[model samples]
Target: MAIVKMEKMHLLALKSEQSKLMQTLQKTGIVEVIDITGDKKEEEKQGHKEDRIRDEIAKELAELETKLNNLKLGIDFLKPYSKSPNPLIYGKPDVKKDELSKILSNETKIAESLQRVFDLDKKIAQLKSEESKILNQIDFLIPWQGLDIPLEQLGNTDRTAFVAVVIPRKSKDKLEEKAKESQLPLDIKVIGEKRDDLYALIVYHRGYNEDIQSLFKEFSVTIQDFMGLKGTPNDIIEQSKRRLSDIQKEREDIKTQAQGMNQDLFNFEVLYDYYMVEKDRKTNTLKLFDTDKSFYLQAWLPKERKSYITDTISKITDMVYVEFTEPEENDDIPVLLSNSKLVEPFEVITELYSLPDPRGIDPNPYMAPFYWLFFGMMLSDAGYGIILSLFTAVALLKFKLEGSGRKFVSMFFLCGISTIIWGAIFGGWFGDLIKIKPLWINPLDNPMSVLILSFILGIIQIFTGIILNGYKNIRAGNTADAIMDQGLWLVLLTGLLMFAIQPLAGIAKYVALFGAIGLILTQGRAQKNPIMKLASGVMSLYSVTGYLSDLLSYSRLLALGLTTGVIATVINTMAKTVGGSAIGFVVMILILLGGHVFNILINILGAYVHSSRLQYIEFFSKFYDSGGRAFDPLRIKTTYVKLEDL
Candidate 1:
């Protein structure tokens, strides 16, 4: 329910045992390594030049990173062919320590498999490129297949020249008439017509080539080239088609081969994770400094794990020296939150906003109940609640969701329970479908009551925030600030609220006057000029409107709650109106199911967003001081496999 306490750690160990020490600390997963190698000023201040000594592991780390990348590429290539386990059912596959070692022992085989996959990918790429060119050649040949002369024979002779041209059909007659007028020793044979073009083979005497070319150019004819092609169009087309069939067969064979390597996919995954862990270990070494005989390291660890970490390091080497000290007031300490399992899920809410200050309180325990209440109130539908609860319950039990994933689902599960309670209270069981009597007042019949209840709830939350702020101020020994600022505001707000009650109306005015006078005196006490101070104090009273606005924001609770009920009722009414005949009844059932599903999805999103908005805007504004960095410790980080002890 609070930020975990941390302590600074300085360690000295033999240079030879540095690797062992790092491995031990990494397995403990409790230390955040820091680089002291570049702290020249600190080293000079301490008069310990030994701290400046640093080791270079960049080359080794880079090599390991390259290996990891290759392994990742191989795994991705094989994923589609592999029988991957469903994350919903199996989560991440776990690799035992012994199993990891066994997999690594066969590293030679895995490397060969990876190389094979790479080669196959390269070969397939080349084959596809070749297939594209062949298909284009076939397209060109298909339009000229009627020509009988071989392509090589269409080049030239000493006395005669051969050429192929395609000219627009509208200009064919004109070109022929022009050729006749020129009387050039040329003959044009129309091989075939395709679309708007006429494909023709033209033979002309070499001496009259220029004249024939001029005649052809009059029609905007396009000359065709089949350079170095030896066979006729039909023969070439047949050969290219056969080659295409072969390319297809070869591609299929390559795919089959790649699929056969699916069993080795896990091996690739394990090796990738192995390299990744090694890379992390090596990368952290950059934060360390080493001498000829010894090495120096600095880190921060949780106070609670001090004994455990020290003991683990002691077992690794007896020549090691370790010291721990309290963090300085100005130290930029990383924050790690600790909370009970029941309250843990709501930490996601705070994190989504921002991490709380290390010196401040964890807001999860305080904000969870209000968020749960608000979310349920907004979504208030018993049927939807039951469905949400059951679905999330199954997901939580079946899937090994980790980190924020698990927290979000668990939060929703709890919200579902709250929704069910509120729905039952309001007598809303799927919008009057079950005919259940009201356990409380229905918002539709008397919205004013629900509206009042929402404002009251909002007031309670706002007051709670102010109280927490006062507590924080008191903890920091600013008792006067707490009372003058927070205490007086609470007094004024509470007194003003009391004036609405019949029994307390007589005393409420006096209480309100005292609170207002106190605020007017204290709010601007820091102002030096008398006139300015009085004016500032008077103006401070105007902020009551902000609090009033905050209270009004709770109107959304009633609005959303009523919206859900009204929409559900509309869906039911529309269904009944059409459910008179057999076909209509079928459509009615579909409409009910689909409409409710859509309604649930849309409203759930709304409830989450609006509920979170209230907390961030109205509640947290009073006390939360954010902007703390998260704690990151050195541990085995694997993507495909969760490492476990055998």
Candidate 2:
């Protein structure tokens, strides 16, 4: 597997054929048009009026975008009242091109329906707001129900002034005694008493209004007034209740109308996709160079698709000129990965790091095996594996997932299979529940073996990366640099590893010595000063520490594997300890189910994160060249409905 080969394409066509050619290209969805008019000198030489054409296309695109946005807003407003489909069911509704055309032709009718729904929603919201205000007023007036006088008339009298006030229950007696001691002409009547305050109505002649105000200030009484209210408390309460009922009924009627407009939602979706397709088509046209009566375009196409594209263009028009040539050596070509189906899912990981350089090799196939092994080793449990595999399998089967979604689910499915294999080898079926004999040593019993295995795997991956780097160098005709930079280290590192083991120490020392001498001689060959060259070569030996650190990092695999088993065993023991009675058994079942599910989720996340970390930081550091741009082809971009081929 490698990066797909691409050819640079140049096309010239008459203005009459430009629209037909663009439409065909968009439908084919394989050509990534590039603008050729870069500098003012080139634009003047070509005499192309791209700016005006671009402005026209941009205006059309903007209008389409506005229409699409309005349709989306309408859909969101009606969604609450409409019948929602099952969320787990994925994939856009398939609509034929003719059907989409029909929907577009009825755009005015659709817009009217959306406007109607929007107006109804606005009215319903206003009614609900009014209803809420009335309900709050009803609550506030509940304690004042006993008052028989109109609220407005309480404080409005030519001869006498009236006020409703609430005084703290504890201070009411003292205030009344003080008022009597002053021989005030205030006529006070207790209206209502809540837990903390006594509501009272006070009436006085207009001449004593000042005295009544001063008495209220001394007692810290709060005067209550309902501004602009003309009816008694009970009368207003009945009117508010009736108004709330009417508003609620109006809202229900609006909701019913919205429910009946569900068919409009489907129509809106089709139109949204149609407009999106048109918008993208118009946007792509901006990339073309246009003259007064002709247009020219450049693109990069897959080498294999050149024939198909040529045939399609020939069918469109015979007046167009198309030429394809190999990309220049210095061309910054976009990269598209080519891989077998089994290796494809791992491309997601590669893309996350960054796509491989167009000239560089695809790393997905190389990285897939290591990623699979690492994930399974970190989350080693057969039961958890079974659950993960089954879940992803169902999702893959039930939904028509595309692009990154399909790759993500498929990658996890493969990881689950690996987990099952490792779990079976370790004899871990839900933390010792099955008690089957292990094909390999149990990590819990002999963790040192597992740790050694992890280190061995790490060493293999790191060395594999170095070897791949060497291969790349060889292909680039830099064999000496490859040998000096990577081959010497491969030998030296292998010797160091062998020397660490007691059995190979006698043979390994000499091998390491030879590698060291070779590195000293060749690692700093470019330095002219002899002493500086030797010093540089000596300093280069320090990179062994980086390799050592990378190898030690794999110890996490053993650590995580042990943690999963221990937590699972603890869950099992806790469940069994409380499972002696009937009720206890039910509790135990719940604990067993929920506890294991939680454990699986946490460990799975850890596995994915750490596994990706190793790939990104440790393994890919050896040979990957990032920063390649992705291939973006002209195509129909839809939101709600999937359009059939035109």
Candidate 3:
């Protein structure tokens, strides 16, 4: 709540003491420093470099993850076609990076091969689908001995609706006589038609298949002519598979080569890791010589370690540099390198839910508890609360999420806790599961009681913020403002407002007049100018309305609670009706699942958003600097490979 005053440190320290302080500060973080004056540039450069390294690591990890995703899909698809149900058992449990890269390359090539095969497969399938239609059309032409449909004319060509049987033009009248008596089994499109001498051009289908090649071959002579140029699709398909196999074998060899390189890369990385630690231990170590970094340490360690080196080191170390101050503030909070602010509670929950990433920002300390309370308020049904807690626990324990999924699940858990309490108060759980109805009517049944409780809660929370603000302000040495502008004024105004609108208690009348007079007098001194100060006093009196406004805004809590209970009641009634019949029972199951899920989602969102609004507008307006930087400690951050385990 309050910032602790830092005792001005002056100290003569052993080289070791300064180093320990630096390490301590590193653990806490850089952002907590009001000012960093010495060797700032080097620190900045180191920080940037660290960030870049982390980014590179992230990029590589993302590539690995993507490859893993593709492999998963490929594995799923190829499962039935595979040599065994467990391809993983056929090989090593983990693939080396180089081998993985090669595998990915081959995976791409194989996918392309599959595409080629699929396209051919599509053509073949379509040909098979059209088999009956083509056969039916050509059925009549089958018995025509030398009436001759040439295999070469099998594709696209036009035909006249009827051909005259005459050998010369003089026999055209005979053709017309034959046409009048016969009909041709044909498909035609008449291109041109005339009246006196009917003229026409027509269109029809010509079918081709490889099986027909042998029957049509009698029309040709030489070996080249006998074969013609018929391309069979099966031959192409087999050839593609062969090429794919060859490519796969080639990829295997490349993988073998890459496997050898993997060791070299690993060794290089391990060696680099050792070098970094060694270098950090050396260059950044404290020395007896005066340095710019404003840190020194004093400790009551055993006097034996300061033996022969102590006297000589004292000559180089400043003679006037010793001071004693008790530790505060940072002692309790666990420090990390990436802390940037009062890390939100939401972020903390995220950390709890997911695998910790070194580079991630923690917002959990700030956001979680409030977020939970807000969520509970939004969905004030006990049944929903119990449901949320169980569901979240199952999900978080079962199939864990890596990033924001973890945060949300954690948030639900916290919300569930709050909801349980509120639900008990509101007589929730399908309207009192244990017949533990609320002492007072539920928010739905008694709106006034709900509003009154909401206001009281709001007042308590608001005052809590004010008290915290006063503490911080006074500690930060803004005494005048803490007393006049913040603390005194808030107390006075809140007191007056509470007393003015109450089931007037014993001291209500006395408290209101005292609070009002104090507010009017103190608020008058806020401005330096006489005229402005006078007007400020006048506004202070009018600010009774402002107090009313703040108190009234809390009614939204009731509104939200009412909204949840009403929605649940509707769902419950619907579920009862649906459970009446067999079909209805099935529908009820779906409705309950879907409706409750939707309700949970919507209410959770509403609670969080509205709660945050109150905190920012009503609560935080009291006193929150929100400008303090988070403590950051310099350290290696890793996820997949646990360091202690390693």
lDDT of 2 by residue, 94-211 (tens): 8887887787788889989989977987897788788888888988787788889988777757888888888888878888888789887777788878999888888878887778
TM-score comparison, 1 vs 2, better candidate: 2
The Cα RMSD in angstroms, rounded to one decimal, for candidate 3 relative to the true structure is: 14.4
Residues 1-646 of candidate 1 have per-residue lDDT tens digits of 6899999999999989988888888888899998766764544433344434322367677778888888888888888777678755787788888898899899888889889989988898899899999889988878789999999888689998889889898998888788788787778898888899989998889998788777778789989988678789999999999999999999889878877886688889878877888888888887876666877898989999999898999998899999999999988889999999878998999999999998887888889889999999999988889989999999999997889999999999999998899899888888766688778989899999999999999999999999999999999999999999999999999899998899999999988898899999998899999988888899999999989999999999999999999999999988888988999999999989988998888888999999999999999998999998899999878788777751
Best by TM-score: 2
Residue-level lDDT of model 3, residues 1-646, one tens digit each, is: 1122223223444433554544443332221222222434654444554455445545655554554344344333333333332312232123354644454355545455344434534544455455444444333222222223332333433532222111222333444344334432233222222232222211222232222232224322111121232222233334445655665565455445434443333232232333333333323332212333333333221122233224434454553354434435443222232332233325543333332222222233333455566557667877778888898888777653544566567666767878888888788774332456774568877788778778777777766666666666686788876786566557566566556555755566566667666656678785888888777876777866765676677778888888887876787678777687889999988877777778767887787678767766666555543323233223322222112211
What is the TM-score of each predicted model, taking all chains together?
0.87, 0.92, 0.51
Pairs with steric clashes in candidate 2: none
Superposing all C-alpha atoms, what RMSD in Å does each candidate have to the true structure? 4.1, 2.9, 14.4
How are the candidates ranked when ordered by TM-score, highest leading? 2, 1, 3
lDDT of each: 0.88, 0.86, 0.49
Best by lDDT: 1
Better of 1 and 3 by TM-score: 1
Lowest lDDT 10-mer window, candidate 2?
Answer: 39-48
